[model samples]
Target: MDVVALIGRILFVVLFLGSGFAHLTQTEAMSGYAASKGVPAAKLATQITGVMMIIGAVMILLGVWSDLGALLLVVFLIPTAVLMHAFWKETDAQAKQMEMIQFQKDLALGGAALLLFALYAKLGDDLGLTITGPLFK
Candidate 1:
């Protein structure tokens, strides 16, 4: 069960980890797109959230302060979905569908993050983990 849980955590965080890397490596491109979407302080927001995403993923992966990590994801996802995936603002049918899909995906991931936080809070002790901890403690 522990192994399964570990694998699940790894799988869940892969996307976030990859995204963080992308944000760091492709800052100019991402920030430009973000600016086009009317995101204020686009580059700064990208860099900050990129770092947060990496930190959060690491915390969740190592089961160190997983709840806090999940909360970070929730924070990242909400504004990201709203600002980046505004499907309703699109007029092109195909573009709207694509944006809607991305929006829904972000919402689903945010919900999962919330669930992870709740589970960590409730079952941390049982799992020999702590919801709040100094990394890997």
Candidate 2:
């Protein structure tokens, strides 16, 4: 069961992990797009969120302070979804659809992060994992 849970955690974090890598590797391109979207300090924000995503995903995968990791993701996802995927502001039909899809995806992921936090809070000890850690303390 622990092995299964670990595998699930790894799978869940793959999107964030890959995205974090992309944000770091493609900072200039990503920041440029962000700037187009009126994100202040676009480059810095990109880098900071990238680091947050990587750290959060790692913490969740290791089952160490997973709640904090989930919270990090929730924080990153909400504004990101609104700022980056403002479908209602799009005029082009196709573009609006694409943005809407992205928005929904982000929302779903955020919900998953919230659920992860709740689960960790409730079952962390039962799962034979340390939910509270030095970071959380």
Candidate 3:
């Protein structure tokens, strides 16, 4: 069960870890896309959020302060979905469909992060293989 939990955690954070690395390494290209989407200080925002995603992924993967890591993901996902995947603003049918898909994916991930946050906050002691446990309690 502990091993399973560890594997689950690893799988859950994989997207974040990879995407976070891209956010840092592909800063210029990512920031340009972000600017096209009207993100202010796009470069800085990309860098900061990259760090957030990487730190959050590491925390969750290591089972240290997993709740805080989840919160970081929530913080990153919500705004990104709203700002970057504004499907309603798209007029092209295919583009709108793609953006909507991205929006939904982001929301789904955000919801999962929220559940993780709650799990650690309410049941940290019961969780298997944790290091420092939830930072909240």
User: Could you say which candidate leads in lDDT?
Assistant: 3
How does candidate 2 fare on TM-score? 0.92
Q: Mind giving the per-residue lDDT tens digits that candidate 1 earns over 25-87?
A: 999999999999999999999998899899889888988888788889999998899999999
Candidate 3 local lDDT, 94-128, one digit each (tens): 99999999999999999999998998888885676
Q: What C-alpha lDDT do the candidate models reach, one value each?
A: 0.87, 0.87, 0.93
- Cand. 2 Cα-lDDT: 0.87
Deviation in angstroms for 114 in model 3? 0.5
lDDT ranking, best first:
3, 2, 1
Residue 64 displacement (Å), model 1? 0.7
Q: Which ranges of candidate 1 are over 4 A from the true structure?
A: 128-137
Clashes of each: 0, 0, 0
lDDT (Cα, 0-100) at 55 in candidate 2: 92
The residue-by-residue lDDT of candidate 2 on 14-131, one tens digit each, is: 9999999999999999999999988999999999999999999988988888888988999999999999999999999999999999999999999999888887776774544444
What CA RMSD would candidate 1 show? 2.8
In terms of lDDT, the poorest run of 10 residues in model 2 is 128-137
* Model 1 worst lDDT run, 10 consecutive residues: 128-137
